[model samples]
Target: MAKRKWLRGLALLLLVALLVVGGMYLYGSSSGTVPPATVDFAKLSPEQEKTLYARGEQVFRAGDCAACHSSPQTGAELAGGVPMVTPMGTLYGTNISPSKQHGIGNWTADDLYRAIASGVAPSRKLLYPAMPYTSYHQVTRGDVDALWVWLMKQPAVEVANRANAMQFPFDVRPAVALWNAVERPAAKPFDASTDALSRGKYLVDVMGHCAECHSPRTLTFALDKSRYLEGSIIEGAYAPAITPAALSGRGWTRDDLVRFFRTGLSPQGVMTFRMASVLDHSTSHMPEEDLRAMAAYLTQDQAMPGPKPKAPQGEVNVKGEAIYVGLCAGCHGVQGQGQPQSSVPLNTNTTAMFPTPINLIRVTREGLQERDLPHGGRMQSMPGFADKLSDQDMADLVNYLRQTWGGQPGDVTPAQVADLVKTIEHGDQ
Candidate 1:
């Protein structure tokens, strides 16, 4: 009798669990299915079509379509097998080439638009934010159409879509839909009144997706609007605050931004890691007009400015000075004056002068690596000392640099270094 009762109890437990799961799935709904686009390149006049393709190509570069979609293997082009390491799990980029079977060849213009601007797929499935569709949603219709044209023209590859490695609950697609349903309404829209400011807003907020990297996130992983673009830590590098308040003390100007975009170097220092990729693949190739527009938008406080960094208090570390003399001074110079050919110069550099020393710690620990340009030029990568240095050593080293070069205090602690090391080991900042 006890055995029979036990079996009945097990069956009841299983049924209850299923009901709970069913409830969750039913509640987690995505957006409606997107219809196929009606616009066709075949319908346009030859000159008009040519202009679109050209314009689309410009959008392609500005969007840096190749950065995410391009396969790592040489000659793969935009065949799409790049793996993005996120806090959730490893997600691979999908084949976005024009393959009817493997890529977006079958997707309609409306389908593409909705997916880019709404984060919804034709199947009514919510694309993971790992695809940047939340940011992409701000992209304009003309730019989306242009991107569609350019993508369709590229040669399609037969590469298969690699499955994402998300943990369960998160691995469930409906959960992503739930986020979309709750989060979409809150994203601020571009509402600038002036034409120049409006144009700049579109480029920075929509096409450039600047906040995608620079902004900090809430526990839900949504970009924290309260601290938008004030700066954030990224895996393998620091995404600095570009806010006027952050840049003001550093002597950054509109012309300085233009020059940095064009050369991947500011008067302060060289762009490194992903920023370097952005410059090489997108901004460097952008028309000077658009670059100026982007600068204008950033200058005009698209997001309300954060407080400027206060000068830190303290003398340079004695141990950190010894480490720099032995290791870093070979390149950055005895006085932290970096070389002309080095990736970053110490003096007037943005990394050191930032309020927090997380960036300096990150670069020193993990190092920086920029992708080679389409034209075959590549910047030198910073070598990581994680293998060689202790947590206390890093804290001391960074604290010293910030104190001396930035005229800031030595504030980084060994405990923080230990935490950063733990985070970086798990593939995040």
Candidate 2:
């Protein structure tokens, strides 16, 4: 009787495995649909073409193309060697530069548009969702065409394409099809009725793809649109909530936001995280009118209820306070006050006040450096203490900063530090 029961259980397991494989096979074999581009280049005059090309450049910047496509040190503009970390695996950016040998030089305008709108490559492979095609799909056809033109015009480098290091089933392109069929929303026609609102919606949802970093994902890795930009952690940085409810007591005005979008600075602090990258590559280049439209749309009808400062300063370890005075005080200022001349401000900074602890932990361990901010000019840098400070010391130090400087109460643990270390080093699976 025992022998018979074992045989039945083994048979059941095999049957289940076969069913899953068969379902995947069916999903993978099917080809996804691609829509046609909206703008008709054939009918346009030479002057119109020039205008479209310029418009396309703005759109590309708005999409923050350089953040991923251009490598940090060695890669050419849009040559694509940056590696993007996703839950499934690591994905390397491709050479979209127009090099006929290794880049998209051979790709026609239609192919480019199809890739952007449908995430379907000309080679018939299904591109990953990490490229934000779901959001790009909603972009206007004219803008998409303009983007294509601009991309094709860039100097093509002979950089080789890098394969994604995704796990078993995810490594397969067809698997993305099944994920898309369920997760990807149908592209809606541009609604021009709301004027600035429609433009804002398109810019935020498509061009900006703000939700890509700010919002959390579902079990299958789809953006949880219900929560919208309520904020989530991305690659170890705290992307704090930007909604009205979240911004209520923060005291950041629309003017502050508009200025930040252009200059990457605010009264609270400088754009220190991935946001700094966005401002450098994208928002700062946008037209003033478009930027205002985006601001109006983002803030909507929400009223700013002035400042609501927290309670009295909390206690921090003496050692942590000493570390702050010795290393951090000169720049960040004592008791979290930023140096008057520097862009760095601490008393009302978002990094310390945010409920999430990743940014603080990261800045403490890795430190922040001023990189290329072509539009915003060069900002200051912070030297890292990864080697100098232990996990406990760093935690105590951060806790001290939050309490004394930020008027926020929080505690940090060594174990949390360990997890953050892992996250910063290995990235998510």
The lDDT leader among the candidates is: 2
Model 1 agreement with the true structure over 1-429: per-residue lDDT tens digits: 999999998987776566545535644344433433335666877887778789888988777666667777754757887777777777887888788887888986777777777676666666788777667665656666777877788788888878889865566665565577656532323444556667777778777888888988889888889998888876645678877777666657777787788777755777766676677668888888888888877787434322233354576699888888887888778876666655556766767787777668767877766544333344566778888888888888988788877767787889988877666666674
Per-residue CA lDDT of model 2 for 1-429, tens digit only, reads: 999999998997776566556535644443334456665766978887788889889988888887778766684658887788877788888888888887889887777766777777777667788888877777666777888878877777887877779875567565566676777765543555567767777777788988888787778888888989888877767788877667665666667777778888767567766787688778888987777777767778577654344554666668878988888888877756576545476666767777756788788777778664545355677788889889888887877777765566757787888887887776652
Model 1: CA > 4 A from native? 1-42, 75-77, 186-194, 301-312, 366-382
TM-score of 2: 0.88
lDDT of 2: 0.74
Every model's TM-score: 0.84, 0.88
Root-mean-square deviation (CA) per prediction: 4.6, 3.8
Model 1 RMSD in angstroms? 4.6
lDDT of every model, 2 decimals: 0.72, 0.74
